[model samples]
Target: MSRFPLFAMAVLGLGLVFLYVPTLLVIATSFNESRLAGVWTGFSLRWYGELLNDRQFLNATANSLIVAGLSATAATALGTCAGLVLARHGRFRGRVLFLGLLATPLVLPEVIIGLSMLLVFVAAEQTLGWPAGRGIGTIVVAHATLAMTYIAYIVQARLTGLSRECEEAASDLGASPLRVLTAITLPMIAPAMGAGWLLAFVLSLDDLVIASFTSGPQSTTLPMVIFSAVRLGVSPKINALASVLVVMSAVCLGLAAWLQARRGGKVLPE
Candidate 1:
């Protein structure tokens, strides 16, 4: 173990530096008072103040949050059910097909998914005459579809680590299947469900391609706005926005961990 300790430590440190240095740099740049993002005149929250007052950015952020929340909720609900079925139900009919459908979105390129959604929406409007125009609802659905598979994968993996004994015991004690599901199964898998919801929320929030395809006029998301701003040039405000997102993501992960530690007591091994 001591033979190559220095080398192993060097490699680990190098990898962490490579992964985190850029993020650290971005966070530092966000506080730069200069109009240019890369230049650091002095530490200041000037850009953040500006960002807070920017109506367009705030609106886009609001849109992103709304879409992300709704999509994550929908994905969590659907994905939990799919995960339950795949993990618990044995040799169900069309299981292979169901898995194929779930896996397709995960493997498909984002551009393809976005374009396909666009085509489907256009076709639907042409035929069903519903969804008169693309907006938050369409974006929510697209994001949900894109994120659902990921949540299902997480939930299914978590379920695999769990023993079915509690559920079996509940059923043996005269609990109905529905009761077993609601009282025992769901609570036991609550940590995985929470983790899945966070994943879905982050996935939907960070998405650019799929959201762009489904978004209509006045439905721009934060990513879209950031991309457009980047096209012009990376400004201090954009850096501030990135920093805000970074902080938000960190807070979310911390919260999820805390919740898992609290709610996952004895259900699965730590």
Candidate 2:
């Protein structure tokens, strides 16, 4: 049992293949000359050329990027605050209600969240005359609301594992609470914050239902466009787009990790 577990290795290999085989195939099919998936002709980049030229796809891509960036930033900010409060504070009045609000999005279905947000926006606009109409702003708010829970969970878990000795030592050294937070607390948790931001970005970029509910005319995100296209028929162009997204996600994560490591202050205190 202490030696190599042949059966476990076999299972792990199978699991990896099962998970990544389809992704590899999709990437390969994106370069295929054929429009269909099963029939792969010689390698070609026709679909990539077409996808870049597609006006609707370009517009949707822009919209998706804008929403993802704004939502991820907002979600991370709110979530970090929520996480700090939950993790640092002991029991307090209304703490249960506060926790419930933070956790609600994680438990509830996306469809329900989208619908509820839509309703809230509608009511607010009718009464308060803010937001005038649904569009990028509404989508950003919806995504932020739906995504902040995930960021909160990440930050909370990170904070839970972190040693508070650093902060305590800093306080004893005459640093104010805010100084300790800015210098010691924030640096230790920077990696988690970055990861949470990336996760939120991916969620907002990949979301379709919530975005659909909140999106107004001319505000369609990439997923919405892709969904609409898929309804008509699957094309190699979609595969091309998927490959692009996969590559872009990988690049972003890798770049963030590299930057974090380069900064060199995020390590946990011994």
TM-score of each: 0.91, 0.88
Candidate 2 lDDT (Cα, whole model)? 0.86
TM-score (C-alpha) between model 2 and the true structure: 0.88
CA shift of 5, model 1, Å = 6.7
Clash pairs detected, candidate 2: none
The best candidate by lDDT is 2
183-266: candidate 2 lDDT, tens digit per residue: 999888888788778878888888999999999998999999889988998789998998888887777667555644654523
Candidate 1 stretches with Cα past 4 Å from truth are: 1-8, 261-270
Cα distance off (Å), candidate 2, residue 93? 1.5
Highest TM-score among the candidates is held by which one?
1
User: lDDT of each prediction vs. the true structure?
Assistant: 0.84, 0.86
